[model samples]
Target: MFLNRKVELSLLENLHAEGKPKLILLYGKRRVGKTELLNEFARRHRALYLVARQEAYEGQLKKMSSEIAEFFDDDVLRHSPFQNYDALFIYLAQKETPVLFDEFPYLVEANRDLPSILQEYWDRYFSKKKTFLVLCGSSIAMMESLLGYKSPLYGRRTEQILLEPLKFREACEFFPQLEQEDKVLAYAVLGGTPAYLLEFDYGKPLLENIRDRILQKNTFLYQDTMFVLQQELTEPRVYYSIINSIAKGNTRLGEIMNDTGLEKSKITKYLSVLKDLHIIERRVPVTEKSPESSKKGIYLLKDNYFKFWFRFVFENAEYIEQGRQEKLIGDKISPVLNNFAGFAYEEIVLEYLKSSPGFPDYIFGRWWDKEEEIDVVGLDSSQNRIIFGEVKWKALTEKEARQTLNQLVEKSVEVKWGENLKSGEIQEGPEKKYMLVGKKVGGKKRLLGDGYLVLELDDLVEN
Candidate 1:
């Protein structure tokens, strides 16, 4: 059932081919398939894999000793466990085999000095041997800290990978039987997490899958959002309030503070934590020079499932608990489903444009001001061009497409992006391009003939 991650497998294989002592770090959020990728690689090579659990240090050491003894066929070693982490690593260092320590943070939690012990062993023994050691974890912050300047393991890893979720198109591969539009809807709900995608039943209707698998009390995904928060944050309720506020249309910092009744400072800290977790992100206008410090930065949930949960599931928990799934879906979700999909469709189009042929090298983002907003904006400094686009979820006729195009053109002029870039290297006026992305464009041929980049659902899915 494994899919994608060809590049990751290739990287591991290449590292193994080197036949030298190497320290590799693999980390990401939970359910991102880090363990799956590691298992696949382990199966391909003569490697010993140990998954650390939340247990006493002695228990972990004994379990690992048993696994190692089994792996090496050394009954004597199994009968006599190593005295400490250092002795165990010393024995492993001479074996010249790949040893993967998955969920490494759990081991660290059990023994605070494990990192220092590994560092000492690595410098004295393992570093000189043809050993491939991998330290993997789901705790993003903890895993990243191992490479920070303050950590004992800093500057020790030969390679590191911060694995990300699958892209929209890659996720579509999970449900080949579903239509393109259904695939999009499924992606919007389940996101690109491989584990989540497997929970969906493509044979069933989309709403049925959502109700039975996602919204029902006994299902895995019913409280998944809360579970993720509880695992990562100390104050889950405050974080939930912040996420709920954003889901309820309070994106701005002030708005979130007002809605959540939390102090601005607390909001800032919680927002930073959420951003690090990849559950939320801060967005600024595409044209802004310094996005990090921009005053217009607004927060949004980056995970589609969280966005959907807060909007629909969290908001209507009572109705769902009352076994009113039918009314809830028909009344609350059906009315706003199209509108919600409209926002997700914008993101999908942006992803499409990133791999689209003929699109210049650019930084893609949204653009907005007090007066107007553009759904998609691409700033190609190399080509001295800016692409302005609008996305409509409904089918569009020729006249509607033309009007949308004209409106985009008019808004592009108002922004005067060229003027903003005048101080930079590109002194000339930037060429402007117009694009329309929607479910369907009735007169796509005519629109293409008229020099417009019109993309329909089919075009998006196919490309």
Candidate 2:
């Protein structure tokens, strides 16, 4: 079930080969495969992997001592557990092996001094030895804090990896048995998380899987959205309101404020926390000069699973709890699923185009004004070229493709790139490129012949 992460594996492998003491800090959101990657790396080398849990400080230490003793085949050490982490870590430092502490934040939770303890041991013993240390956690905030100037473990890590979820294409690889469109639909619901993707049964109909595995009360993912929020935040209700508002299409700040009735300052703080957790994102128009300072920023739930949950599951929780799964799907989900997937499909198309060999080095994003919005915008600064693209989740005929392309061309003119170029802000007047991406474009050959770049869903998936 392991997929992608080739680059991450290579980096770990290189670290192993360095033949020196190393401290590697790895952190990511839950279900992002941090433990899996660490276990896989452990299998390839002489390593002691200990997964900490929510337990007393003494209990965790005893458990870790047992594992470390067993890993090093020391009978005496196993019989007599180390009283403190310093002693255990010092013993580990004597051996040239990697010691991986997964879910490290749990240990920090049980013992506030663990980071300082590790810092002291790492500086006194491990740093002078050939020991490799990996402290992995699901708490993004806690792990980042270890690198802060005031933290005990500051400057101790030789490398750090904030692992992220798989991309759309990699996620699609999980459901090879399903049709391309069905794969996209499943991704729209399950997102790129390996754990979530594996829960789905590709042999069944997509909706059937959704009903049985996600919508049902007893299912694991039924309450996953709330569970994740509860684990990451103290006040889940406020975060829920904000996420729900964004999911229900209150993307703008004012709209979210109006919908949630939360103060602007409070919303800003919650949004910052959500952003740190990788649950939501603040996006600005592609052409904006200062994105951070832009007043036009809009909020979007970046995690597909969370978006699907809030939009479909959370919204229809009453129906689901009433055992009306079929009614919920037909009345609430099916009619609007395509529209939801359309937005995600646009993002996938943009990702595919970004990875294309023909695609120049460009700053890729969407452009929007009060009246007009462009789904895909790529500004190739080196070549002084701009690409404007329209993405459709549904199939389009030749005539339809031409009409869409015409609209995209018209919208490209409305973009302020020309004015910026003329004002000597950008060196060259940009050469505009138009593109159309969709499930299927019937007149793709003709469109390409007519100097428009056309990309079908098949092309994107295959590439």
Candidate 3:
């Protein structure tokens, strides 16, 4: 299931090759494969790895003491826990080795003063040494708080790595036989989680994989979200209700609170946790310079599988558990698939547009406070530039696409790219930018005399 982790792999490798004393912090969501990556890295380096267990502070320290004894050929260090970690610090200072602490937050939780202690050791002992100390965790709140300003470890960390899910392009490596359209569909369903992607059977059809590996009775991921919730927080049901509400399109703050029977004030904390977990994202239209200035903040479950499950399957869990997945997919989910795919297609297009060349610096999302919403908008603050784009999953012929382009020309006047453009002269503001993204590209006529850009999934898969 290992696909492309090019960016992360390269960074870690370069850090090691720098031949300096570096402290690396790796943090991300649970089951996003932080440990797996660390293990792979450690194996390559022949490093000493110690995973802090869920035991008392003294017991865990004693376990580490034993490992250090075995690693360094010092039998005396095994009998007792390194008193206050200063002794262990002194031992590690003499060696130029890679030392990793996985699930480090457990050690921190077992002893709140651990970060302060590490800070003292780093400044007094380890900072001048040549060892690479990597602290890894899944709790974003804990990790960020510890390394953030005002925390004990602030300014002491040399580097931080926040691992994300596999991208759409990387997911293609998992199922080579799967077509580009199917890769996009898989990305929508799996949302790039390596754990979820590993469950797929490359030899079988996508729907068959979904039926057996995802919806079956004893599937690992059937209660996956529940386990994640229980491990991370105490009040799982309330958070579940709010997440389910958002998944069902109850996006507004008031709407989510009402649907979940939670107070408005409490909703913020819950939503913040979800955002930190990278399961959901809150977005305001791009017109506003910052989130605070915008009143249009909308929350969405960013995890595609969770969104799909909450939207259709969770509502009919009884039937799903009774082996009605096929019927449910036909009766309830199929119609919504196109609609859902349409939204996902829009997201994919927006994401690509952001990273694509020729985009402006002040790129913002567009919504007209009505049904007219542009999928992506690139705004050039320096040059008063406006680019409009549309993403279509359907097979659009050149004529149909040209009509859509003409429609965009009409909609272009409504968007305020800046004050420089007069009513009839918005096109004169800057070179007009228009894009059409889909499974297949229509001819140049769809460009509407603007700088043309066409993106087809076929081209994406080859790269």
**Comparison by TM-score, 1 against 2, better one:** 2
Question: How well is each residue in 1-463 modelled by candidate 1, as lDDT tens digits?
Answer: 6798888889989998998889999998888899999899889897899999999999999999999999999999989998799879878877867999999999999998989999999999888888799999999888988989888999888999988888888898899888878888888888888888899889999899888897798888887778877888898888989999998889999999999999989999999999987789999998887788999899999878888889999889998889998888998988888788888889888888877776758778898887588899998877777778999988999998898898888777656365564222444577767889888998999988988888889888876
Best by TM-score: 2
lDDT of 3 by residue, 1-463 (tens): 3457778877888888887778889998877878888888788897888898888988887888988888877867766558767777777877888989999999988988889888988888778867689999988778888777998889989999999876666766776787667777777777767888788786786667666777765787676867776777778888888888988889889899888888877998989888877778988766555667667788988777788767765677876768898887777766677677777767776766566554537475655434567676666667755677777887677878778777877776666435534324654567667767777766754464556667776655563
Clash statistics: count for each candidate? 0, 0, 0
lDDT by residue (tens digit), candidate 2, 336-396: 9889888889888877877778785877899988868999999886777888889999999
> Model 2 compared with the native: what TM-score?
0.96
- Model 1 residue runs over 4 Å out of place are 416-428
The predictions' CA RMSDs to the true structure, in order, are: 2.2, 1.9, 2.6
**Lowest lDDT 10-mer window, candidate 2?**
418-427
Candidate 3 — what's its lDDT? 0.76
